[model samples]
Target: MIRTLQSGQQCQVRIASVTGESTLLYSTHRILLEAPNWTLDGRSLILNGDGKLWRLDITSGTLIEIPLGGIPDLNNDHVLAPDGESIFLSANDGHIYRAPLTGGHAQRITPDDGSFHFLHGVSPDGAELAYVGIGGGDFRQPGRLMTIASDGGAPARVNVGEGHCDGPEYSPDGKWLYLNTESFSTEPGHAQLARIRVDGTGFEQLLESKTVDWFPHLSPDGQYASYIRFPSGTQGHPADLPVAVVLVSTGDWKTPLHTWPLFGGQGTLNVNSWSPDSEHFAYVAYPPATQTED
Candidate 1:
């Protein structure tokens, strides 16, 4: 189901620089926006709201809808294609679609194999995609790491373990798929940052923490990463929570270089939002409107 802001709540679009500065790019109470994707040219940010795609021009602050044909309402799971002119979208109908960035007919990529496809990353070479598949659309079943050709084919499962995982994004070098998984913990919903080889070997946990982490997105240059940290006992990345977006050096993921505390989850930093230059990344925040002194 598409989620909306409750009365008196507001959505904020923000960018955080690796050098430790934060900027509020835009905000609204009219609609709930989430999961920003920085365009390859660094001129705009792509976001989704009300089951549709929107592009926000950073310089002019113009927000426009990118129309799509032959696709269901979109979810927060979307990734920019490596080509810079197209995107891969995971619609609410349990299928992934490819559409031009300029907006046009969306070509369905998943083969309807009785699994729900949630898109995360496109390979650096643009030949493959990494995502999480929920078998038979069952929430009770653990999600499995999946990969498929960018043009569409039978998806292959990359075994990390028998646990729920999400945000299987490719490292900028095309060697590792970064994600958060429950395999490291016996505690339910205790997803920790992890990475596995594209060939399905060398699975390693990146960090150890009581906080439930989700979505470890690497910068385009592969120097830094950003992820959302939920409360210790939070289950399944729920919305409207007090979450923190932590930035860390890829070489030493244990120590945080910076952290931005905000009121959002689920839709905040679910995808890679790093600018092409890798200097800045974007995210969303949903906070209640402040009471006015009338």
Candidate 2:
């Protein structure tokens, strides 16, 4: 469970347990939590706050700050390697770094050639990494999805075209790469969830939504795909609210197995990581605020 607090005119995040029957998991104050990614063992959480990486131990309720070496300016969306040994994080300097999970120096994996690269997912075997590379000098321009070996090699483009692609994740079997494609438009801005073969063929659309839908994560069991869905009519503003987490069946994308409300809306409430058992997922939820008259 997550909670939100009112900080003057803004909101902050607070982490709690999902079980409603337990009062021990509740928090009396809200903290600035964002972009929570789970360790492979589900015993810890990795999140970005204060422009730095933090590891939280669930059992001990301790928060340990991890230094990002020389690379700073990493937003949320940092993923832990499948072995839980290393962390892949994207820096504001247009590069990706691999660092030890226990807090040490981070080695620059991707080149800082002024092209933006965002780290999204690591293969279950920890051999490959899926990322989105934006063209031009800035990341806001058009981009495509690409995958490269963890040891560093030639990156292969999995999706190519004029459409903007973001949030790439690999299936549990490591056969398919899931992502969201957004065409530059103001009319509804259709964003669809898609999957492509690792070999860069057989691209297929799994789901479509009028509002923005991204951050696709395949459950550990390979049964469901969980994503964040922003409701229609709210776009390109801080007033936008994440409505729910839509869980779609892997075999059939037409139907949703479950939909849960995010409750809080101001802060980042996107789904970033899943438990190893695939039963429960972790997300950051901020407290909702009273609506003001326009």
The candidate that wins on TM-score is 1
TM-score of each: 0.98, 0.83
Query: Candidate 2 — worst ten consecutive residues by lDDT sum?
Result: 19-28
Q: Report the lDDT tens digits of candidate 2 across residue range 1-294.
A: 132345532333333222311112113234556667778877887877666788877677677788757777666557888787888888767677888988788888875445677788888899888888876546457667878788777777775446777778888888888887765443544556788888888777777666666667887888767777777764421333646656777887777776655544323433356667776666555434553211
Task: Give the distance in Å from residue 281's predicted Cα in candidate 2 to where it truly belongs.
Answer: 0.5
lDDT of each: 0.94, 0.66
Clashing pairs in 2: 1-17, 4-287
